[model samples]
Target: MADIRRRKFVAVLGGMTVAWPLVTRAQQPVKKIGFLSVSSPGAHAPFVAAFNEGLKEVGFLEGQNLAVEYAWAEGNFDRLATLAAGLIHNRVDVIAAMSGDVSIRAAIKASSTIPVVFISGSDPVQTGLVASLARPAMSPASA
Candidate 1:
């Protein structure tokens, strides 16, 4: 009877040891990212798909461990700032500014602290997005 009880206890302890990490991971909060764009959803469908694929490559999946909040200006340049502000209000971990420098600027303006990742055709240095490409002043290392 003593041996049987010891065996059962050992088995339960082993099971819990194997499952503990998974349980803790599940209890951890999901990461949230804001997708801010100056174009319509339909127009930027391919870009969004690519972005999601990139996220998957980096071990992040939408609605799984990560949540994406999308804000589109629908070609209205004047609405970029408002949309960016809305994303900031949503409390995203980071803002992905898509479409152009305008969207990037809007996201940067929305929150000074929140990190903004941008896709721009123009020179970011000339646009004042970064001090230099080799040493981006926005990063802590440069600061």
Candidate 2:
């Protein structure tokens, strides 16, 4: 059974690999990713580098296919809302809330259509950002 499951998984993965480019080609080119941070740019540079490295591992390169727009609050929580709004105005395809719950909340309140991906220290499900870890709630774009 385990071998059969593995074969099925490999088959699905191979199919997805062949279909991935076609799916992406049907969508908008130059995908935009919004980055929201509570720290200053200087302080978050290493984090940004790590993020870029991760993206590179997935075959994505900045300025070529993926475009990243950064918004830093510089320890000022109040600025996060405005930054989120600016990213929404720019129509970013997805928002990466790099800070804590504050940045995540700001991004959630900013727009419903754009999908928000957050890395938080707190429990996202308990905080009501998601229904569960296994299956996230759909954004307005998906709806």
Candidate 3:
């Protein structure tokens, strides 16, 4: 019985491998990511620079290699929608829209196809930013 199960598993795995290329080819290309925040350009410059440094540590760089878009609201929650919409319009791969629940909601409302990562202080699930705290929907970056 074990041998039969093992054979079946191997067959399924082999079939999946054979079908992988077809699915991979249908996938889209690499995308630019957008960072939406209310921090002033100067206020967030260091953080951005730090992020670039971290990326470089892992073999990535901005402008020369990676593309990053910034949509700063300059300290106003009301402006989040406009900035988030702009990122969605740009077809950004993802939006790193860190604020509270409101900002996350704004970004999500602006676009569904493009992924959004919301960094918040409270229980993400309770705030409804995530479906559940333990097993919320996640992307590679957010995961």
**Regions of candidate 1 where Cα sits further than 4 Å from its true position:** 138-143
Off by over 4 Å in 2: 1-28, 138-143
Looking at candidate 2, the ten consecutive residues that score lowest on lDDT are 134-143
lDDT of 1 by residue, 1-143 (tens): 99999999999999999999999977778888999998999999999999999999998988879999999999999998899889888899999999887888788888878898887787778768887889754532222
For every model shown, what is its TM-score relative to the native structure?
0.84, 0.73, 0.67
Q: How many pairs of residues collide in each model? A: 0, 0, 0
lDDT of 3 by residue, 108-134 (tens): 788767777757888776656666667
> In candidate 3, which residue pairs get closer than 3 Å at backbone N, Cα or C atoms, i.e. clash?
none
Better of 1 and 2 by TM-score: 1
Ranking by lDDT: 1, 2, 3
CA-lDDT, candidates in order:
0.86, 0.85, 0.74
Candidate number that wins on lDDT, 1 or 3: 1
**Cα lDDT of model 2 by residue, 32-67, tens digit:** 999998889998889999999999899778877799
